[model samples]
Target: MTIAFISDIHGNFEALKAVLAEIDRMRVAEIVCVGDVVGYYSQVNECCDELRRRGIPSVLGNHDWYLGYGGFCTRSRSVNECLVYQRKVITSENVNWLRAFHLQMQMDTVRIVHAGWSDPIDEYLTNPSEDYFARLSGTHFVSGHTHVQSIHRFGGKTYCNPGSVGQPRDGDPRAAFATFDGETFALHRVAYDMQKVFDRMEAAGFHDYYYGGLKTGAKNLRRLAD
Candidate 1:
């Protein structure tokens, strides 16, 4: 059975739709989300509704926690600003759904978390060492944060990050995801209509500062010149 993994949607419905279409075409048997269902984009409600409609199981991401529970992000002021805007537009039902997400999940042998195992909601697994993977108790682990797609193998164990569907930061301006076929994790990228996202963000009153890096897949969020 092939299981598709998606993460960090961040309210980009166009990207999410494109990814889902690809997953459907690939005939994946199951789909799971690593979270960040709402953030950094304008279609927060649409993204949430799609995921919930598909009954995708997802872990709690830091952004989701913030919007769902009224928390704040200290790492990025832009993130907090986006959260503030999202809160006003997101439905109460969607907020309730986001609040119900778990910190971690165990799907047979595959352990899933939104960020890292130690701090599921906020750790960016950018450069984990062999020791870090060794301490983990599972052969297959999945996480999504950092918006970078990656796979690390250590001591016969494997870790995979499906990357970000909404805001990719891996130097590849494409929607990113992964698939597990009970053995290896395969990374995939699909191009989507980014202009639609831009238009919607503009209509929603967000400036280019919120989405400029999406075209180049820059590691950091775009900011205005100093």
Candidate 2:
């Protein structure tokens, strides 16, 4: 089965729409989102609703937890401010849906998480050693959080990050995602109408940092390189 993996959408409906369009074109059998579906952007509800409508299986993200449990104040001040603004706009139903998501999921030979399987929502496997990857139980472990696209092979397992779909930090502005067909994995970078997402953020009165991140995927790449 061909599985399409995406993550770190951060509520950019335009980017998500573009990615979905591409996924539809590819005709993948399954689409899974790694998480962070409701942070840093203005269209949380729209994004969540579309994911629900499509019946995509998604893992919960840290941002989703912070938004649902009113834990924003304890997180990063900037992220707190963004969540506060997001809370004002997101619907109660969407919040509940985010709350219901699991931090990790396993299907056949594949394992999915917003971060690493070891810590799920909190730990990043960006620089995991061979021992670390070997410890993971799945043949294919997929995660996204550092927002850098990479495929790492260790021992007998494959670890992958599809990067960020809406707010890529990988220095490349193009939207990043990946596809796995059991034996092979392919990374993709697709261009979207960033100006449209920027305009929506402005119209919604979201903070500039959110929109600024979309202009370039530099932040994500920097984090990965670190």
Candidate 3:
């Protein structure tokens, strides 16, 4: 089965639309989202509605937790501030969906999580070694959170990250995603209309930095993909 994986959408409807179009062109059997469906952008409700409409399975992201559960303080002070601002504008339905999301999912050959399987929703395994993969007990482990797209082979297992679809932090402005065709994995980056998103953010009256981040894909005053 060909499964297309995308993550860290962060509520950019334009980016998600472009990615879905590309996925249709690829004729993927299924589309799986690695989460962070809300946070950082202005179209949280639309993004969540679209994901639900498409019947995509998703794991919970840190941003989703903060927005839904009101516990961003436990994650990071800066993230807390961002979530606090987002909460004021987010709709009630989207918040409810995020609150009920799962942290991890296990499929036949693929294990999906917003972060590492060991730590689930919170910990990030950016450079998990051979020992880490050996302990996981899955042929393929897919995760996203760091917003850097990479594929790692350790022991007998393969680890794949699709990066961020809307808020890509890998130094590339193009939206990043990945596809797994049972045996092989391929990363894809697609260009979208950034100005359109920027205009929306402006009209919504979001923080200036929020819209600027979309243009550069940088966060926390750091360049993309620190």
The C-alpha TM-scores of every prediction are 0.97, 0.93, 0.91
Return whichever of 1 and 3 wins on lDDT.
1
Worst 10 residues of 2 by lDDT: 217-226
Model 1 accuracy (lDDT, Cα):
0.90
Candidate 2: tens digits of C-alpha lDDT, residues 84-163? 88999899999899889998888668888898877788787768678887665668888998888999878688888998
Each prediction's total of clashing residue pairs, residues at least 3 apart in sequence or on different chains, is 0, 5, 0
**Over the full model, what C-alpha lDDT does candidate 2 score relative to the true structure?**
0.82
On lDDT, the stronger of 2 and 3 is 2
So what's the TM-score on candidate 2?
0.93
lDDT tens digits, residues 1-226, model 1?
7899999999999999999999999999699999898888999999999999999989999889989999987767888888888988999999999999999988767999998988998887899778998887879999998899999888789999999898888899899999999999999999999999999989988899889899998887685110
Q: Candidates 1 and 3: which is better by TM-score? A: 1
Q: For model 1, name the residue pairs that clash.
A: none
The digit string of per-residue lDDT tens for model 3 on 1-226 reads 8889999998888999999999999888699999899877778888999998888878998788878888654644545555676788787887887887888887669899998877677677777788878876769989998888889887678899998998887678788899998888899998899988888887876556655766666643232221
> In model 1, which runs have C-alpha deviations exceeding 4 angstroms?
223-226
Alpha-carbon runs more than 4 Å astray in model 2? 73-75, 220-226
Q: How many pairs in model 2 have backbone atoms within 3 A of each other, for residues 3 or more apart or on separate chains, i.e. clashes?
A: 5
* Rank order (by lDDT, best first): 1, 2, 3
